[model samples]
Target: MLPFAIGALRAIVEMLGLCLLGMGAMALLAGAGRQGNPVYRLFELITRAPRQLVARLLPGRERPLLAGVLCFLLLFLLWLALAAWRAALA
Candidate 1:
């Protein structure tokens, strides 16, 4: 049961990290006008969940992109720690 939960969390963390990377790429290549378009909107939607989570975690920060980066780092660290622990347990 514990291993299952850890695996699930690791999967989620990986997904979030990948989404953030995609968001970053979209930000770099996509124009401001394209934000309303479907591709950009999809990236925005994927990134929004982590942004909202980050916003709640860091209330004082005004920059959402920075917060999202921090959020991705946080999840990555969690995933790494969990992987280590699971390996140690095994």
Candidate 2:
């Protein structure tokens, strides 16, 4: 049971990391030009939810990429802590 819970937590952390990476990348691309690029379109579509949520949270923030970078750094540190805790439990 403990192992299963740890595995689930790891999976969730990995997914969150991926989501943050994608959001940060997309936000960075939003500046160079948003049209005529399918990759940008796809990323924009995929990251819509979290980006919008972040935008709402920080209304005065003028740059989405900066926001994404901060979020990624925060989540990365959190993931490291979770990984360490899981290793200790194991």
- Top-scoring candidate (TM-score): 1
**Model 1 C-alpha lDDT per residue in residues 1-90, reported as the tens digit of each score:** 888888888898888788788777777777566576687678677768778878888867688777978988987898899999888878
Q: lDDT scores for all predictions?
A: 0.80, 0.66
Q: Could you tell me the lDDT of residue 46 within candidate 2?
A: 59
What TM value does model 1 have?
Answer: 0.80
Error of 2 at 58 (Å): 4.3
**Residue-wise lDDT of candidate 2 within 1-90, one digit each (tens)?**
776776787776566568667645655667556555676566566556656666667757687766666656655776787778778888
Predicted model with the maximum lDDT:
1
Task: Name the regions of candidate 2 deviating beyond 4 angstroms.
Answer: 22-31, 34-38, 45-59
Q: What local lDDT does model 1 show for residue 86?
A: 81
The worst-scoring run of ten residues by lDDT in candidate 2 lies at 27-36
- The TM-scores, one per candidate, come to 0.80, 0.57
